[model samples]
Target: MRALIIIDVQKDFLANGFLVVPEGEKVIPVINNINHHFDVVVATKDWHPASHKSFACNHHEREVGEIVEVNDLPQILWPAHCVSNSDGAKFPEDLNTKVIEKVFEKGTKEDVDDYSGFFDNGKLNDTGLHDYLQSKGVKEVYVAGIALDFCVKYTALDAKALGYKTFMIEDASKGINFRPNDVQNAIIDMKVSGIRVIHSRELEKVFSGDY
Candidate 1:
């Protein structure tokens, strides 16, 4: 079976978000159009606590976009956006949530940051996504959503690492582009790591189920 992994389409990543990704809202229509193409649909959320170390405000004088060391991990400081119960953390009303069978939350651990839906940055802990997908007999995964250069890229790499055939839906994912070429570099990283990067249009014939 195949699954669609929608990564962090929360309000904070959208146009008026605290840490807005370039054209983040553009992914909504693409994802909504292709979500039902798979047998299962799952989403990921950036559920961070107020005191999470990845937030620049938590550090003495660090600013957003600065890289800091946390628990020996190189953590990129971000503007506090996805606070656990905040409005910014909630999925947008435009997202088709009814088809999402489950949602796996990440970045919950204050000590470490989690970019991938499957595991924490250190790979010390998992978000139970792998086990759930395995239980559902999903051998292939199509990943899409906000921040293509960060969360979406990491999630796709981790999906391939976990023995699943992983593909990144380019048009359905937006990039934060901290650097001008972040999105391109992310695509290179995925390709070298054995993950296919594709557009939504190509999926029609490939995943042609009655879904």
Candidate 2:
């Protein structure tokens, strides 16, 4: 079966948000338009605690964009975003969430950061996404969402690692280019790992079973 795994489309990643990705809002319509074409659809959320170690606010005079170590893991300190039960953590009203079957919450552990929808940064914890997809008989997964360089990229990589035939929808995702060429490098990494990068338009006929 085919699945569309959407990553971190929460309010905090939108325009004027704490960790906005460039053109993140643009993916909402694209995702909405194609979600029905899939056999199943699931979403992921950041769902961080207020004091998550990845947030700069919890550190002593530390600012966003700073890198720190927690539990021997390197972490990029971002502005506190997607705090659990907060407005920032909620999906925007305009996003078509009715199509989402389940929402896997990540980064809930205050001491760890989870960039992938499937696993934490340490790869020590699983978010149950893989098993859930397995239960749904998903063999091919189409990944799209905000921040292509981070959450979206990691999710796609993990999906591939878990033996799913993975594809990344470039037109249905946006990147957080915090540094030069971060997006380009991420795409290359996925390609090296055998993940196909395609545009949403390319899937129309395939999804409709008319190809």
Candidate 3:
């Protein structure tokens, strides 16, 4: 079976939101159009507590884009965006949430940052996404969503590591690109790690059993 994993298409990542990823909202229609091509559709959200340590506001003398250590793991300080129960943490109104069979919430721990849907920053805690996919007999995963260089990239890498055939839909995602060429570098890294990078248009071939 195949699954489509949509990662962090929440309002917080939109252009008007707190942690805007360039052209992030552009992926929504693409994701919605591809929903029916997969056997299962799953979505992930960054549901952080108000005082989560990943936020730059919580750290004294630290600024956004600075690297700090959280639970001994290198963490990037970001503007507070996806606080739990906030509007920014919710999926955008345009996303087709009805097609999503499961919605996984991550980064809930105040002390840990979770950039991957499957695990926390340290990979010490899983969000149950792996077990869920295994239980559903999903052998391959197609990933798409906002911030391709961060949450989307980590999720796809983790999916590959867990023995699933992973593919990232390039046109169906966007990136923060905090630094120059960050998205380009992330695509190279993901491809090097065995994740096939494809465009959203190729999904039609996949659904037709022609790829």
Error of 1 at 3 (Å): 0.1
| lDDT tens readout by residue for model 2, 1-211 | 9999989998899998888888899999999998988999999999987889998889999889989999999999898899999998889888999889999999999999999999999999999999999999999999999889999899999999989999999999999888899999999999999998988988976566663
Q: Over the stretch 1-211, how does candidate 1's per-residue lDDT look in tens digits?
A: 9999999999999978888988999999999998878899999999999999999999998999899899999998999989999999999999999999999999998989999999999999999999999999999999999889999999999999889999999999999888889999999999999998888999976666522
Q: Which stretches of candidate 2 lie over 4 Å from their true place?
A: 205-211
Clash count, one per candidate: 0, 0, 0
List TM-score per model, in order. Answer: 0.97, 0.96, 0.97
Worst 10 residues of 2 by lDDT: 202-211
- How well does candidate 3 score on lDDT at residue 26? 95
> How far in Å is the alpha carbon of 187 misplaced in model 3?
0.5
Give the local distance difference test score of model 1: 0.93
Candidate 3 lDDT, tens digit per residue, 10-38? 99999789998888989999999988989
**TM-score between model 2 and native:** 0.96
